[model samples]
Target: MTTPQDLLIIAMDVTSSRDIGQGDLSLALAGAELVDLIEAGALTLDDDRIVPGAAWTLDDALLSEAVSSLVRQEPYESVEDWLWRRGRDLFAAYRAAVEAQTPVAAGRRRWNPLRGGPAERADSPARRRAEDRWSKGDPVLVGLAAAVGIEHPDGEGAAPADEAVGTVLDAVHDAETELEAVRQRRSIENAAFDNIWRAP
Candidate 1:
């Protein structure tokens, strides 16, 4: 399975005390896509900017679309910019794709560990592979998961050996932090509004 797919599965499979925010997952998913593209030789990172590589075919439809979405012109998009632009509602897209691939019963909602429901996917090879990677603490997967607030089972994961991959991971963390700040600001504003309304 691809990195983004594995990451999505991991997010869905998470049994964390709190639900992973959709915004956080979307940013992490974008970062996973970039990491996979770099591995596939579809792109490279020049500092923080993405430099698209030679034309290539990706077997995965979503990944192929990601390639198509790359900024081919010079001064290509920075990893941080790409994460925000491509990550918009990315969680919903991946969730729909996974649900499409995995069949569900007529009336039952798929079990999500975070949501506490019945299991959705059967014991498939893809899932087993993702689980194996998570269990072994694959650096890239661990990094992306951590950005979205999912800690490794054995604490923090080691940094990836690949410099480019590490760059992408760092971008994901920065973007997630920025998003969280925005959330906090909105929360504070809403609370102030509520206090004003409740004042004597």
Candidate 2:
């Protein structure tokens, strides 16, 4: 009497029962992990995984429980798609913040005494390029901050004077509550799928 369709219904009932007994929301991860295991099959989606897109399938509709588990994990390639997407890495954020604290100029980096250096000798392309690169270091860092969404959170608001890089990082750091919610959701989904996949 255990047809494939019936099997899905059974799994749902079983997981629901476990969920009720545990009483702790964190315990929901077991159920989610079950579904993940099943969907992952022989390959995983983590960095160690060599074969990409192994879990890109619709096998969970047949599972009696956690149909949404399969559906959720399928679209997690980019940071924005991750259930708990964090800010870009720390080095990136920090550099952005520092850059925001400073300012610089563009164009051929000529050695101007105003920049705490002696005047460049005329016709020296090497010195000119070197000066330009050195003077633009802070600008480059500021650009990094901009790339990391720094204009709004690490240290201050996205304003004319605020250090956008640090402000962005700060904002992201302050989002602990939001991050927790994403983690909890992912945990629960993973729990639902764990049992479906296993070691060889």
Report, for every candidate in turn, its global Cα lDDT versus the true structure.
0.84, 0.29
lDDT by residue for model 2 over 61-109, one digit each (tens)? Answer: 3222322333334333421222122222222332232223222234434
Candidate 2 TM-score, true structure as reference: 0.18
Supply candidate 2's per-residue lDDT for 126.
32
Model 1 misplaced stretches (Cα beyond 4 Å): 102-108, 111-120
lDDT (Cα, tens digit) per residue for candidate 1, span 153-198: 7877689998999999999999988998999899999999999999
lDDT of model 1 at position 56: 69
How far residue 134's Cα lies from its native spot in candidate 2, in Å, is 32
- In Å, residue 169's CA in model 1 sits off its true spot by 0.4
The TM-score leader among the candidates is: 1
What clash count does candidate 2 reach?
40
